[model samples]
Target: MDDDENLPRKTNDPLAALVKQDLDPLSVDELDERISALKSEINRCEAKKSFAVSHRASAENLFKK
Candidate 1:
């Protein structure tokens, strides 16, 4: 009477499979590596903005304390 009865199932179906591997938290080394990469990216953007601000001193002076 319904489309639900028409589906074919497999032993390897992703939705039906149970994960056998033990789940583990990310290691501190991995976390630190990601943090260091992010820091470098942030520093690069800050340096670029600093250079642009210095070049546009007249426009930037409006916000100076």
Candidate 2:
């Protein structure tokens, strides 16, 4: 019975923390995949930001009336 087997694994990988990952071992295809994934994440975040801004503006308009 190994004692290490009881430890919980860490799987949270928010995009900002990804910049600190070691990239020296990745192949070209892996790097391309990372780039594509990051781009998709950026777009998703932008969409959320826009929605939040619009929602906030709507709330403000309602209160002003």
Candidate 3:
């Protein structure tokens, strides 16, 4: 087997495209807006992660009883 088979394959992911976007053409205001949007997305992801963790812990506790 080739060593390349052990590596993860890339998909047509929107997040990956977003990260690769050319930002040099954007104005200062545009950059600020992009930063704000990214920050909001980060917060949303964190909230979902927190909820999932808590839910899993609850399930484990219930199963232990």
Against the unseen true structure, what C-alpha lDDT does each candidate score?
A: 0.71, 0.86, 0.93
From the highest TM-score down, the ranking of the candidates is 3, 2, 1
Residue pairs in collision within model 3: none
TM-scores for every predicted model: 0.47, 0.74, 0.84
lDDT accuracy of residue 47 in candidate 2:
100
Highest lDDT: give the candidate number: 3
Over 4 Å off in model 2, which ranges? 1-16
Deviation from native of the Cα of residue 63 in model 3, angstroms = 0.4
Q: lDDT per residue, candidate 2, 1-65, as tens digits?
A: 79966875456745436766899999999999999998999899999999999999999999999
**Regions more than 4 Å wrong, model 3:** 1-9
What overall lDDT, based on C-alpha atoms, would model 3 receive against the true structure? 0.93
User: Over all chains combined, what TM-score does candidate 3 have?
Assistant: 0.84
Model 2: lDDT equals 0.86
| Candidate 2 weakest ten by summed lDDT | 8-17
Best by TM-score: 3
Q: Residues 14-63, candidate 3, lDDT per residue (tens digit)?
A: 88689889999999999999999999999999999999999999999999
